[model samples]
Each structure stands twice: as C-alpha cells, then as structure tokens.
Target: MAFRQTVGKFLGNHAETNENHLDVSLQTHYYKTTKDRALTVLRNFFEKNEKFRINAVSNERGEVSASIIKGKKAFIVGTVIMVRPHQTVVDFSVTTESAFPFDFGYSTKVIHRLYDHMDKELPTIPKTNR
Candidate 1:
C-alpha cells in the first residue's frame, strides 16, 4: 500500500473494492455463479440484515445499494457482473456517516463483513488478473 492509502485508512470514512486493491478484503471477489444469482444473494443479504436498509436494486443491471442503519449509518453499493459462464464478480463500496471526519477504517470493516457473508453464501473462485 502507498503512504497515502496507509494514512487514509487510518482515518478514513470510505472504502471500496477494485481489481487490484492492496487490501485483500477490499479486492473484487470472484464467485462460481451466474450474475443474476449473485445479485439475488446480495439483495437478500442486505434485506435480511436488520442493520441494512436497501435503497435500490436492479436485476437487469445486477446492482444493489443499501444503507447501514444500526451501529453506524453508512451507504453501501454492491455490484455483480458475469465475466464468463458460471464466473461472476462482486464488488462493494461503503462510506460511513460519522460526526468526525474519520471512522478509523469502519468502512473497510463493513466491506470485509459483507464479503465474508457472500463468501459463505456462494462458492468463491480466486480472482484472476485482468
């Protein structure tokens, strides 16, 4: 990780996953499932979890947005896309609402938890460099 990322994570309110993020938990995840199935799983998770309030969901786009309303108010976006048959990708973006400017990596932890939940719901395949 870069110096800026190090400091930002120490006192940041936002975190997102990408193809090459240094944080493994913040990297895009690959699952052996169809995009629609992956989207359904994500939507179900956000809806079932009392801490989350789902904002929007698009089955056609395979995207879902939700807000965390319990411990910390935060907005989260989940996206799913199928690269190949039975190969889907899931990514998350989370931003915490805080009185102070920083949440001390709370957003990152939220993403980690979401990913962990998804991992348990579906079979995961190792992410491939692209």
Candidate 2:
C-alpha cells in the first residue's frame, strides 16, 4: 500500500508552464469574515490533515506555507489579502515534488481540491466591492 501510494505521488507529472510550478488565483471572493478568520480557516484545514505540515503562518500578512507528503512531497503556499473591508483575495501555489520532468495535472488537482474545501468552509460569499 505504501509503495503504491509513493508511486502515485511520483507519477504526478506536469507538461509545460515552467516545470513543476502550479499557481492559481481564486476569483475575488468577498467575505464578511476578517483576514485573520480566513487565515485561521486555512490553517485549521491544513492542520487537520495528516498529509500536511504547516511551515509558516503570518496572521498580520495573511499568508501561509505548508508541506504535504501523502504519497509524494509538495509545498502548498497561499496568501489571503484584504482588498477592502470584508473583501479578500486568496491565491495559492502548489509545487509538486517528483523525479519526473513534469506533473500530469496532479498539482492543479490539488489546488482544485483546496478550492472545493474553501467553498464548503466559507459558504457566505458576499458581493465584490470592485
């Protein structure tokens, strides 16, 4: 089982876009929640998962970096910024670790999974200030 999982992780290979970097910005989501709250949500989500280990978190800056090693090793870096009162922007970067030259959309899938989690966690999406 462990060997199968490890192989699955290593098989995560990407195409272009500069090797193994996958970055994405969630459509501006306005929330009634504060930046600290958002950061907490992110931290808690990662902390609850045994596959992830948070390396750094800055409440003041609203950014976090975590390492995930379920089958393979990768870093999950994200930022939550307050554009206006009760309006925030969240961006994430998932860089997979693999011996292969590229990831076959595994990194992107990871980001999409996180987005789904956030959507469920923060159900109240307010109108954008912009």
Candidate 3:
C-alpha cells in the first residue's frame, strides 16, 4: 500500500476583541512518505514571510504541524493538509470585527489571493474510492 498525505491552512482575525492581532495556523501530513519534505515546505514559508509569527511546530507519528500569528487588525490565517504521494487539501478564511468601508471588495480580494496561491502550489486532489 502507498502512503497518503493531508495538509490544511486556516487564517482569521478578531477585530472585535482586539484590533491588533491576527491568528494563523498551518498543518501538513505525510502518511506514507518521509516527514522532511513537509517540514521543509513549512519552515521555508515561516522564515520568508515577515507577516507570520510562528507559534508552534510539532511532529507526531506521520503528521507535521505548525501554527502562527499574523498581521495586526487585518488578520490572515491559513492551513495546508496533504494526504499523500498524491493528494493535498487546503481551507482558508478571514473575518473582522466590523465591516470596513470596502469590506466586500476586500474580502473578495482575499479569497482570490487564497485561491490563486492554492492553485499555484497544491493544485486540487481528485476524488478516489475508499
């Protein structure tokens, strides 16, 4: 049997509670492959992105996980879960305490950026029979 992988990313902000903090999380899984590849991808992202402040990274069995904090007021969070030699899944979202003047446009741009990044990086996994 071949190994599989899963990756997830989540991003959000709490403008109501505190307008100066953003929460971010990233998680990657390597079911049948080595953990090094996942770790390398995650570590490189953290190191390069000044907006992200890594909170944690842990490995348990076949999972490689990471969490971080990002931007003040304008929160951004993302997660990446890979299910493996062939599958990768990602989910990302954002929220604010009060809607800004250009809230609709802003949100749309954010979503677009997220989708673009995912498309460029992970692509999409095809459904398979269990």
Candidate 2 residue-wise lDDT, 36-121, digit = tens: 77788889999999999999998887889998878777788878887777766666777888887657667767777776777677
Stretches of candidate 2 above 4 Å error? 1-30, 124-130
lDDT for model 3 comes to: 0.37
Q: Which residue runs of candidate 1 sit more than 4 Å off their true CA positions? A: 128-130
Residue-wise C-alpha lDDT for candidate 1, range 14-59, written one tens digit per residue: 9999988987668898999999889988989988889899999988
Instruction: Give the alpha-carbon lDDT of every model.
Output: 0.89, 0.68, 0.37
Q: Model 1 Cα displacement at 15 (Å)?
A: 0.3
lDDT of 3 by residue, 1-130 (tens): 1121111111223211111213211222112223444444544565676655444444443222223344323444444444555444444344533443324334334545544544454334333321
Winner of 1 and 3 under TM-score: 1
Residue 104 miss distance in model 3 (angstroms): 2.3
Candidate 2: residue 77 Cα off by (Å): 0.5
Report how far off residue 105 is in candidate 2 (Å): 0.4
Cα TM-score of candidate 2: 0.73
* Winner by lDDT: 1
Worst 10 residues of 2 by lDDT: 15-24
